[model samples]
Target: MRLEAVGRRYGARGPWVLRGVDLDVPGGQVLRVEGANGSGKSTVLRILAGIDRPTTGRVSGRPRTAYVPERFPPALPFDAHGYLVHLGRVHGLGGRTAARRAERWLECFGIAGYARTPLAQLSKGTCQKVAVAQALVAEPELLVLDEAWTGLDEDARAVLDDAVRARSAAGGTVVFVDHDPRRLAADTTAAHRVQDARLVPVPPDAAGGPRVVIEATGGGVPPAGLAYEPAAPGTLQVTVPAAESDAVLRRLLAAAPPWHIRSVRPAQPPTEPA
Candidate 1:
């Protein structure tokens, strides 16, 4: 997906939130869009998602996409999972099929217990999880997420991290808007920070992968950008050519069970270890 000189401003008298921004996001990889709140990160994502039209410029890669906004769309009086089932059906799932998928994701996020809970009674975190599940239920070719971490607890966050990673691995394109540097810079091939109404690349090393993993408290999903396969009983391994292990480990160390780097062995050792 690519944006060419995209710009947008709300209201007749408002200033431009995004100005002359250009970005190219390749498929099967992640693009991290970073900025402070109100810095146009979400605006860019919305434009990409077709939720909002950009005031100026062209955005390619509409349709064939799924977008999860910062706050959820008003589902009014339905139960949380019911709303999700509705969204899933809207995105192409049907009847019992939609309900099944919605139930699966709610369970994955540890919200299965709330499947029958009304949206109004759900916590913000739970609501946000449902909102995220709505976009993710269909597994669209292009995934756009905005401030996706809001209101999420540790477990939900891990579930999200894994889904994003899996999407990228399956060759789906991802555009993510995030204020947290960890989320922005995690396992993505390209990282851009929005400032002064423009998107700029962070230094390559600074935007690199996880550098440390001290411990993993709970088991969930891993971060994006690396392929890890079973190495030994109770162990998994990953190696990235032309990328530093320490850099990747650092990002992995900061997250929950899976992102937690249990140990850092030498990247390359005597032939016997392999």
Candidate 2:
């Protein structure tokens, strides 16, 4: 699936959430979209999910996409599980199939007890789980999630993480927003960040490449790091050039001193001939 030069606008006064956005996400791949709070991240996801059409652009793919929005019909007059069941049916699943799938996801997310609980009575995290399970229940070829980790406990989070990996492994594509660099350090995953109203590459750590872990921000996403994992404890690294060492040091201090900062070192020089 891909979006080419997509753009959207709410009204004359409304700014274009997404413009000239180009994305190419193949099946069996995880494409993470990350940014500040209102950089049109959600807007872009919705467009990909086929919920909203781009104001000016083109998208091509026939795979059934499942979108788990940030908000749903919670605190309403409906049983949480009941709503999920109904949603499954809407997605072309029948009684036996829907029930079985819902049960599995609920159990996986540790929310099976809320199967019959009222939607209004469930916690924020529980609601989030239900929303995610709904998207997965359809067994979609494309999964579109908006802040999928919004409200989930560690256990539940693990379940969803495993599910995502499993789905992608099974030839599914995923486009979701996340603020955790640690969670997306896998080699197979490719990430992009929305900044200056555009997308930029977020290269995951690959072998010896030095990367910094920073929770800095410019616009949309929250305080999240965009650096590679440190190879060793007390080692702070970054992908930027050595010329920016001072800036990187400042940001590191802002993120909090490393467990042990023997000293700040510039880029390592290559060894000469033996």
Candidate 3:
């Protein structure tokens, strides 16, 4: 998708939150947006997801998009499962398929037990899972996440990280904004910051690269062509390349005794000399 000279404001005389922004969102890549609070980052994401329209400029080649906003309304009438199923149908899935996918995602996020719980009664973390699950149920071509990980626990955060990787590996585009500086650092294909009501490209070194430390207990020699460092007794940290990460994961999972695949994340970039 492409945005050309895009600008947005609330009213005819309202102050512009975003102006003259030009961006290209290529398929099969992850993009990160950075900015301080109230800096128009959310506005840019809303425009990209078609949740809001630009007051001026043009957007072209938009694909099937799904978005998870920062603040989810937990007061909705339906239960977690019901809401997800409803959204899946809205995304064009059949009733049975939608229910099935909803269940799968709820299970993936470790909230299946609360599937029937009312949205208003669920915890913040669980509600966040529901929000994320609704978006993934459709397997959209473009996924926009604004602070999607804010209320999630450690395991849920890891699940989200894997989901983001899985989406990009399947030739989808994922755009996100989060406060954490290290979020998906190694995996981001491009990074941009909102500045002066405009989008600015961030240098690669500054943005960092995706680096994951995979630890395993029962393992033979680390996979060839991948770098590994000893982390603790009977464990090794293997840094897998971002693009081929999914393949590496599959290999680890399929290995004899499964290599006890531990964690995957962005690698920290090296510091420059003073």
Candidate 4:
């Protein structure tokens, strides 16, 4: 899908929130949208999700999409499970399939106990989980998340992270906005920031690149949003952008029973084919 010269505003004479925006949403990738508060990030996402139409340009080839807005209204009349099931059917699932998926996601997010509780009775964080679950129940071809991680507990946040990766891995497009720069930094295929009422592409290195490799030991768990795997007995290897290497090192050293650094170096670039 593509947004061609898209622009948006409120009233006839209201100042533009976004103008001259162009974006491509391709399958099997993750796109991160960034900007200061109220800088039109949400507007861009809304347009891509087909929740709001562009005022000036056009969106072409829109796919089956699901969106999780920045604010989730918990005043809905149904319980968490029912809301998710309704959304699944709306997204073209059979009744039995919708109910099954709803149960699965609620369990995955550690909210199975609250499946029958009314939405308005759930806490803010639980409500946010319900919002996210609704978007995921149908396995949308395009997923747009606007600060969908906010108010989620650590475990639920990790669950959502896994879900995003799963969607992208399954050849779906995932676009999201979050306050934390580190959220899914490793998985993002591209990034853009809203500035001066327009969308600006961020260079790969500037956003997060020129990767760094860290060899370490003794840290029980590596930091969140980093790519890592076992290297040797009692040791692990982590890779992240050079820009975030320092922060990663600090986190390792600050952990209880701090991790012992084996080596820190820039990851070797791929060799050209002969």
Candidate 5:
């Protein structure tokens, strides 16, 4: 999906919240958007998620989208499971399939016990898990999150982190805005910041200086958002910033069965174009 020169404003004469925003959201990658508070970051996400429309230009090829906004209505009448199933159906899932997926994600987030509890009765942290679960129940083609991890507990947060990677690896486009700079920083395929009412690219090394090369083998289909090249017959090379090397390593080790590390060292200088 792509946003072409998109801009948004509250009223006919209101000042623009976003202007000349051009973004290309590709499949099979995790995209991170950053900006200071009140910098129109949420506006961009809303537009991308189809919650808000742009006053100028257009968004094209948007697929099945699911959004987790900063604030969720806690007083909703339905229980967590029912709400998720409803959203799943809204996203085109059949009744049985939606119910099955709802149960699965609730279990994954450690909230299976609260499946029948009313949204109004759940604790704040538990409600946040519901919010995250609603978006993932149908396996959306585009997942948009705005501080979705803010209220999650440690285990739930880790589950969400893995969920984001899983979504991207399954060929979905995941776009997120989180206050924590380290949240998925290493796994991001691209980063951008909302600035002066415009979206601008952020260099890969902006988060950390220099880069490190990680060579490993036996990890099938490296986690999405990481760039890798086949090395030896059974090995692959992944280059990430030094500061994010640890996070990268953790991701590798966190995978089921894990990866066998062959080496971690400074990346060699890039070769000049002929």
Candidate 6:
């Protein structure tokens, strides 16, 4: 998808939040947006996710999108599972499929026990889990997250990290903004910062590069020509190249017994030679 010379403002005479922004969100990549608080990072995400329209310029190639806003409305009149199921149906799933997927995701986020609990009564962390789950119910082609991890617990945070990786690996585009500088540090294929009411590219060295650490067990040698290190007794830290990661994953999954993938995450960029 592409946003060309896009600009946004609240009212006809209001101040512009974003102006003259040109961005291309390509498939199979992760992009990070950064800016100081009150900057237009959230505005950019909203525009990208189609929640808002630009006052000027044009956006093209819109795909099936799912978004998680920074603020979730937990006072809605639905239970945890019911909300997810409703959202799944809105995303085009059948009733049974939606309910099944809703239950599965609740389990994945460790919130299945609260499936029948009303949304207004859930804790903040649990509500955030529901928010994240709602976004993933449809396996969308474009996933947008604006500080979606703020209230999540450690395990839930890790689950979100894995979901981000899985979406990009499946040839989808993922765009996100997180306050933490190290969030997906090395897995970002592109980085941009909202500056002076515009989007500015951040160089790879400054913003980190597209590198991921794949942790798996079951004792298998690293694929030939792949760079890796031993992360633990039974784990391998396979450093995937930015462009060939999908191919590498395919090979791993095709291996005998399919080396159980424990986790996938951004690998810290290699230190530069002085």
Question: What is the TM-score of each predicted model, taking all chains together?
Answer: 0.75, 0.73, 0.78, 0.81, 0.91, 0.79
Using lDDT as the measure, the top candidate is 5
Best by TM-score: 5
Q: For residues 23-49, could you state the per-residue lDDT of candidate 2 as single tens digits? A: 888888778887888887888788889
Q: Please give the CA lDDT of all the candidate structures.
A: 0.74, 0.71, 0.86, 0.89, 0.90, 0.86
Residues 54-114, model 4: lDDT tens digits: 7899899999999999999999899999999999999999999999999999999999999
Per-residue lDDT over 51-91 for candidate 6, one digit per residue giving the tens place of the 0 to 100 score:
99999999999899999999999999999999999999999
Displacement of the residue 115 alpha carbon in candidate 2, Å = 1.0
lDDT tens readout by residue for model 3, 1-274: 9999999999999898999999999998899999889999999999999999999999999999999998999999999999999999999999999999999999999999999999999999899999999999999999999999999998898888878877887889999999986677546778899988999999865633465656666766554334467888878776755655665665566555567777776777779999
Error of 3 at 130 (Å): 0.5
Q: Provide the RMSD of all predictions against the true structure, rounded to 1 decimal.
A: 7.1, 10.3, 6.6, 6.7, 2.5, 6.6
Residue runs of model 3 more than 4 Å from their true location after superposition: 207-274
Worst 10 residues of 4 by lDDT: 219-228
Error of 1 at 51 (Å): 1.0
Q: Rank the candidates by TM-score, best first.
A: 5, 4, 6, 3, 1, 2
Instruction: Give each model's clash number.
Output: 15, 10, 9, 0, 0, 0
lDDT of 1 by residue, 50-152 (tens): 8888788988865478888888754588897888888788888788988888888988989889988888888888889988988788887889998887889
Model 5 segments more than 4 A misplaced: 229-231, 255-257, 266-274
Cα misplacement distance, residue 131 of candidate 4 (Å): 0.4
